[model samples]
Target: MRAPALSALDIHLFQEGTHSRLHDKLGAHALPAGGVRFAVWAPNAAQVRVIGDWNFWAEGDAMTPRTDGSGIWEADCPQAAPGQAYKYRIVTPSGELLEKADPFAFQSELAPATASRIWAGTHTWADDAWMRARATRNALDAPMAIYEVHAGSWQRENGEFLGYRELAHRLAHYVKDLGFTHVELMPVTEHPFYGSWGYQTTGYFAPTARYGNPEDLMYFVDHLHQQGIGVILDWVPSHFPTDPHGLARFDGTHLYEHADPRQGFHPEWNSAIFNYGRHEVRSFLLSSALYWLDRFHIDGLRVDAVASMLYLDYARGPGQWIPNAHGGRENLEAVHFLQALNRAVYREQPGAFTVAEESTAWPRVSRPTEMGGLGFGMKWNMGWMHDTLRYLREAPVHRRWHHHQLTFSLVYAFTENFVLPLSHDEVVHGKGSLIHKMAGDAWQQFANLRALFGFMWAHPGKKLLFMGGEFGQRREWTHDGELEWWVTGLPGHRGLQQLMRRLNRVLTEEPALHAFDFGPEGFEWIEADDAERSVFAFLRKGPPGTAPILAVSNFTPVPRENHRVGVPLAGAWQELINTDAGEFDGAGWGNLGGARTVPVPSHGRAHSLVLTLPPLSTIYLKGPTRATNA
Candidate 1:
């Protein structure tokens, strides 16, 4: 290793937490003299030493601390080289000795091992075209149907996991064929426990080695970009697991987390909460976010459990949690940190954005920071998911009494940019599959599931569906096993899969469904109060001149013949999709391919059409573009 070399300004910025790329200056950096320079931040350490394979895991020389008292130590060794396993041995101020892995390591040995590996290779990317046009492709007005996946459980070969390169081809082709615009991966960062589903992150800088090397994961993102599919990584900033080698206690103190247990310890997950008020800790998280976007070319980040970070008393009862300085439950420091994080992310990677998994009615989460908001691009609509699921799980006969649950979400749907997510969370923890959530026999369950997908696609929001949801998998999701791939061969499951493909095709091809997802002007209710019949009908409009598409749903198993519904214009209307058609294992009921509007006034409209309402299904009809009989 060589001697520490940094300007006074670099030290000041790092100390003040303004340095966004601390990885470049810290960790094991290559030296020009055919050696390596290593540095670590251990403020409470009396002395720090570099212990690695080069020194046979023995400490050779003590690293020099910054004279300015920045608490940083550095050294250069001629014996150190790339691919060497290394760690820092620190002598704390209390004279206690401890060894820890590098916090900014770009690579690490696979699990059952905790040593950091020296890596310096950079990946070459061929996705300039995708990068340039990403803004337009990810615009709020454009179509975005995401398929959420857990990498390790997405598929297994011979009961063994597939590498990133192999899964890249497999996952990309599958997503493209399904007509999805993006794939939201569950956390892929390194964590020791396989059951955490990558949420208990230990290596913020390293991609998990269970899949492949860092470059191989880069290839996965690049290949997906080439296929016109954006990739969104699930990022956890709420808290981290208290693994010994992680950021729990460094330098014999709680440097990264809170020193106070009331504020630091997370009771629900048995993890440690980050001290967002600390400058160094905030800089650490900001740098980690940038590292993934800069090195891996990720399109976006789905911030997990943001509500947990915004509240001091989250999941805690009275007297169990400490109040903020203002005597309120709000965590002001974390709010500021999140605002800064969003600002930095958009500034560094233009066109890339973030999503918040905030479950509360926190106002303006997706609004811009300058507008006094959290500044996320969109938010997962947990309210919609919960309310709709609750309503669907009830028996059809009881739906009328609880009909408002289905319509209540529209009242606040446009308050923030929303993504209607039927995510992995819904299918896990004994919740059963989406289809199983429906209350009915085999035939009605399939119909209800298809109807749910049709309604969700037509709703005023972006879309996200978890893996195995396209085809109806009856079992709950488990990290140890792959999805029931054999179920797709079954007739009912295959039909549901086909219905999903068609729904995605129509959602993308028809601008009326996506153009104004965030504004009320895009949606018009023709008959939302028909709770007695458990039926709903609405019109989805595009820009001012474009035609509208009419959607009608029946929650009951009894089909309605000659069901009169309002139409905007008197002309031919094409049947775009029918969830109850025989192809999707439905009762082969539909409007003989098209319907015509009559002069008879109905449902507050000048023109109307008598339609066949299929049992427990939804049908989408495209109205004529030309105006007639105003």
Candidate 2:
């Protein structure tokens, strides 16, 4: 028999919990000599055998255990060929036999089937330009408007799912047209349940075969990168489902998760939580994370359910959870794992970054590890999303009393390099669509949504809008159905789509909007105290030579003529965007093209512009500064 696949150094690192590239050594690999070399980690197994279509599912070819005591079983099967589905038949010490799918399999059979396929990636990438310059494009200061999408539901042909290659061209064209900088895919990793939306991951290394094979998914990312759109995958390292063929009870033991239910199980998700304290499990997760970035060239990863991972008492009542060594509620092991994960990601994939979907007010979530932080690149602004949505649901007559919701986010806008996400979570489980959340009639609802978007874009943070939102889909998001693509035929919906395109263009074109998003100097309030009138105004500033942008919002239904807003510079301010303009299906009440600041004092500024504030709308005006002139 050939020597074991793992070397002495691999054994040391895997045991030490620092091996980041275990994928290259473990799993089934096509040997250059002939056939495939299979390896798996099952220390408690008395014997392990490779069973597959090539071997007639027989137990004749028993795997050899490593002499180094690594508990890894290896077998060189010259008869095993690519595309053959296989599983490890492990015999436990108590004579119990368990057939398990390869944990490190790069490709798996589609849902309703539980076989791992023998495959190797052979995709030739054609995204050199995007890969080379992605560092600057993915920076915190860059304009990043992500269009969150579910691959299967985004679009389907004749009620059938489109392959990854097909979704690639169509999605890239649509996202490019809308001017979104990135497309954040809701997990495409292999899962047994289609309705789980890839969250209950069974094969971390495999792209779901329901869409396409490994190379086809690779083409998906490559094509999007070629079109200058970064890809961010929603990754769930927090917990995994306890399917019989999955990571649960491997080798007749809780190898990947804790044996104690209090520490291992997630009551809310009804899944098994990863035992972050385990050395080999850490290597498995870290390797899984790097595999996507290395093989698929993913631009970033949005770590889902981070708050659940951070707290031991999360979703648990007293005595149902365990405390850390310091007797605190924090999951110390998970904290170390997250910090290590982020450090490894940044060090290995310099251009790529990570975001945390942490709902709690966990301090320094996006800060660096050395600064006593979690070391994530960004965190979702759940507070802002919840507050803004709650305030928008109120009637216009009652908006004045809840005006603080609109202004409260700025108090901590720069806390963790936030991303203002109006995500799919808000539109599911009877929450209704974003348009329906507004407080008004048909026209006013549309107007309120438009104003909310305008204010969001002008706000100091990165932006993310889920699918169906660009065109104002009237129903809640369903993973089983496609977006209402036909709604673009309607005047209001089409106008909303047009507004999204225009807003994205303005966000990307203007440095003042994105360049200083995390800096307080880039923003200032001009009329934050106008709760009685339910009006708000603010200024967004860029670098020295760049032009400044003024954004004003009227939450009420009454239009205000000659609403004086302070201006820092004396110049002709052009109306860059008015959500109420006739083009956006609004009242069409706005300043006639531009407004020139006068010597009149207002809002503590020497010069002020008397502007027309349309009802239930927000407008952005660009000052003619040196950058605009140049």
Q: What is the C-alpha lDDT of each candidate?
A: 0.89, 0.93
- lDDT string, candidate 1, 319-435, tens digits: 878888989999999999899899999999998889999999988999999998999999999999999999889999999998888888889988999999999999988898888
In terms of TM-score, how similar is model 2 to the real structure? 0.98
What C-alpha lDDT, on a 0 to 100 scale, does residue 19 get in candidate 1?
67
Error of 1 at 483 (Å): 0.9
Off by over 4 Å in 1: 1-6, 626-630
TM-score of 1: 0.97
Residues 496-602, candidate 2: write the lDDT tens digits. 99899999999999999999999898898989989999999998988878888999999989999988888878879999999999998888999989899999988
- Which regions in candidate 2 have their CA more than 4 angstroms from the true location? 626-630
The RMSD of every model to the true structure, in order and in angstroms, is 1.8, 1.6
